[model samples]
Target: MAWFRNLSRFSTINVSRRHDPFLLSSFNCFSSNNINTNPTIEKPSVDPVQYSGLGPTKPHEKPRVVVLGSGWAGCRLMKGLDPEIYDIVCVSPRNHMVFTPLLASTCVGTLEFRSVAEPIARIQPAISREPGSYFFLSNCTGISADKHMVHCETVTEGEQALDPWSFTVSYDKLVIALGAQPTTFGIRGVKEHAIFLREVHHAQEIRRKLLLNLMLSDVPGISEEEKRRLLHCVVVGGGPTGVEFSGELSDFIMRDVRQRYAHVKDYVHVTLIEANEILSSFDVRLRNYATKQLTKSGVRLVRGTVKDVQDQNIILNDGSEVPYGLLVWSTGVGPSPLIHALDLPKAPGGGRIGVDEWLRVPSVQDIFSIGDCSGFVESTGRQTLPALAQVAEREGKYLAHLLNKIGKAGGGRANSGKDIDFGEPFVYKHLGSMASVGSYKALVDLRQSKETKGISLAGFISWFIWRSAYLTRVVSWRNRIYVAINWATTLVFGRDISRI
Candidate 1:
């Protein structure tokens, strides 16, 4: 009766006078003589639709911090941020942070994929629980610094058949930690044929391909040359990732493959192709030790430049061809296409997004950058920091503290932190390096630089130290436990060779 009385009042007041099509249609819907029964939706009028996005924050709401990545830098920043001071919004293609140092272990089944991946929610609970905080499974397409907004599009690249939609988010502060992509030196077919070891999925692909090659090589009618080619795994980088993967592959061939896939074990081989010396960042002695250990583990080390990459083989600069079943490209990382497209200033030498000593983008109001995507501007007279996980992690930690300090000073709003005294500039101190070279052998260099004299260790003791250090570095307790269990299982039962 109440609903009918209200409708009668509205109908009585304007039913006769109103000529609006929408209002007339509404009245017709309730007409007793000609009631509409169809539930099908009508098409909308032709008008340019506005993109839906998070608008500027109200005065009463907490300041929003938009982080444009989920790597070591962004995740660390989100973890340390004071959620009560600012709402967190993370935009990344992947929802988890890959423990990169241990990523190679996953490729050879020394560790499970899940063990190296810590979900974004697990790293920062506020993003999942807080009313204003959120995690977006998307890639940032562009940034509008003047408007304090970031443009992002959903990532629906896999099995899902949904179309990607674009959205924008306004932020009081924006942190760019998009990281970097693997360098291929403009070689042809590299992107189409070779896989890079930067993410968990990459490692998974390597594992799947390795197993597939092994099984295929064991086929009854295959020729000897074809079998050898199919079982040959070539790694194109001498850095930590490539070396470690080579070590893991050799270990797998010697231990697990020899016993389980005995028919193809003799044919399985690993070749590490490096343009220069492997582990060039470590001390000379340590590098020598790594080289020797890798060789002793049955990995063939090749010093040559890749001229071109083909589907089944690579052509060297010297007109030689190296056939391989699997190719991994880890020649180090450089700025991504998004970085190049950005109109912001870039650091010299590598074209990374430029930042001041305080990690703030100069001339920009509230934008900052870190991780492999950022570097110091030339004016700062500071050399760009190496693109290492520790460098990114520490930079993120420092920026979090700095932002929290600004928030406490009542400058958490966009364009309001101009006069705040940012206490200290970010100074990077090299914390040493560690790498595992199979057969219970490793290298640990504690020097601040190649010239600096400090503790450097090699052998099984170093391997033990490497394991203990990275085990503690795994993002969450759950993953740490997973990694430890995986390692133990591997040591007891050997590396898992299941293709799936």
Candidate 2:
């Protein structure tokens, strides 16, 4: 239908597809296709390798590994590790991994939502193959560390009332990958009024709100004041998420929205507010460049902390108010409720769950934490690594390698109960950061060391690099093709303003 509306017009690259693993992979969690009535499912044929104390990691007898939250960290670890080694169980409310870096693109019609989302089953086939492995669509509510059990609640609707909706699954090794959520910082009404940018649903909600405002602006007999309010979009928190959304919104307004709603084009506006500075996490050069680029692209940058957010307006520290049709809260991430609920040590100031360099909870063995949920402790006195997808992915791969080494070394055994020796602590290598500010303009901040300054690149070249980098990072070829086609058609025909 409309998916290929103008696809024939552009000479598109044909992406070769990667087939899903043929092995009856255990796709637990929230799959409509593959659901195990029993949490303890049949195991796939084992790798024939032998083990002591714990015995060989068979589907039934292998050390049961439970991974919480299928974000970047959990997903990668599930993919990198051998199903032949550990019986893996993954639990999360969602079954899809939202390629977060390109999420803003989806909000403004630069890319379709499905293209950027990869189902966990497709990425982590090993999890599906593991016997007794459960793909649970649920939230981990409590962890009985003493008993090595995780208390979870099934969130799926339409289940039998008499059926067990909540249960505890015992784990030999537990992984905490429950990523962070939006922090309103106790600002009044923010929790209810402002939209967050943490998940796929957040992006969907933003898209709906954005289009709704546009439609409302076109309604007859609407007052100028109401129209102004309907068209005014405010983005809070000038981090990568906020800046990118503002940029994308700016692009939508200039490239598509303005042309489509020519009668009231000038009334539509975007304002981005930050407590300190936009892209404060980036190098100074890149941050400055982003500020200038966003301003040049007609996104008003307000350097002020938000004190309170009302349904109709945002209140600033200086007591000024800015009316808005849509308010997006992209403020820094905070620990999730599940993290706080655990009786675990938290990092200072940020309240993130603390983990040793091996990504293990120092006080609790067998339970490891990673990604945004866990703060890496450095013996070198370095700051905890930034909560980034790259960092999470790297940690996952490292953890997988460690698990492989441990499985071979017989570290994960029930009878012996020996501590696994992860010889080296995690060392993070900062690659670079990039943010697009509309109109094919972007900024890139390459890594820097104490001895030398890093390289900084901006403008059209960086934008191309941004596109190429994210394109290559997408997991599946089918999704890559879909995203490529969406981008091509958008450039050629502009965004289709279909609200539904």
- Give the per-residue lDDT of model 1 (tens digit) for 418-442: 8999987999999999998899888
Which prediction has the highest lDDT against the true structure?
1
Q: Write down the TM-score of every candidate.
A: 0.92, 0.85
Estimate the TM-score for candidate 2.
0.85
**C-alpha RMSD between model 2 and the true structure:** 10.7
Cα lDDT listed for each candidate: 0.87, 0.77
The numbered model that scores best in TM-score is 1
Candidate 2 regions exceeding 4 Å error are 1-60, 157-164, 377-382, 414-420, 449-452
Q: Clash pairs of candidate 1?
A: none
- For candidate 1, the lDDT comes to 0.87
> lDDT, candidate 2, residue 309?
82
